[model samples]
Target: MKLKIINSDKILYEEDVFYLKAPGLNGYFQILENHTSFISILKKGNLKFKNKKKIKKNLNIEKGILKVNKNFIIILL
Candidate 1:
């Protein structure tokens, strides 16, 4: 899956990720390729993902909005 992280200034990161772990409003959830489209609010926490070969990495973030569609994902923090 492709992920993009943006803040008030500019885009922070953009890359292909195997999967992503995010803190949802109610709980935490994982996003993978072909996952259903949805939107949610996030809390202060780490946003984790994997590279093409499945190497995991993480981005620490504060409150933000998350959106996912069939083609791509956009994360605004």
Candidate 2:
């Protein structure tokens, strides 16, 4: 899946991800390749994702929005 993280100023990240974990408004959720399309509100918490190269990254995000469609992820913070 392709994931992109963007803010008002610039693009923070753009890459292919194998797995993702996010802090949804209600709770934490996970995403993988071929996941269903959806959108959600994000809260302040740790966000985790693994890349195609099997490298894992962690981010502490503030409030934001998350959009997922056809294996593409867009995070607006």
Candidate 3:
């Protein structure tokens, strides 16, 4: 799925990712290929995603919004 991370200034990251794990208000949650679409508020923590090559990455967000639709993930920080 296509994953894009952006803030007011610029696009932080954009790529196709196989898996994603984020810090939700309640706890940590994950997004996978073909997962259902939803939007949620994010807490300050580490945001993680694994690319097609299985390389893991971490993005730190202070607070943000997460939206998933039609296999596209958008994180607004």
Highest lDDT: which candidate? 3
Put down candidate 2 lDDT per residue, 1-77, tens digits, no spaces.
89999999999999999988999988999998898999999999988999889999998999899999998999999
Please list the Cα RMSD from the true structure of every candidate, rounded to 1 decimal place.
Answer: 1.0, 0.6, 0.6
After superposition, candidate 2 runs with Cα above 4 Å error: none
TM-score of each: 0.93, 0.97, 0.97
lDDT of 1: 0.89
Across 1-77, the per-residue lDDT of candidate 1 in tens digits comes to: 78999999999989988889998888889998999999999998889888888688988888999999994789999
Error of 2 at 10 (Å): 0.7
Ranking by lDDT: 3, 2, 1
Clashing pairs in 3: none
Q: Give the runs in model 1 whose Cα sits over 4 Å from its true position.
A: none
Looking at model 2, the pairs that clash are none
Better of 1 and 3 by TM-score: 3
All candidates' lDDT scores?
0.89, 0.94, 0.96
- TM-score of candidate 3 to 2 decimals: 0.97
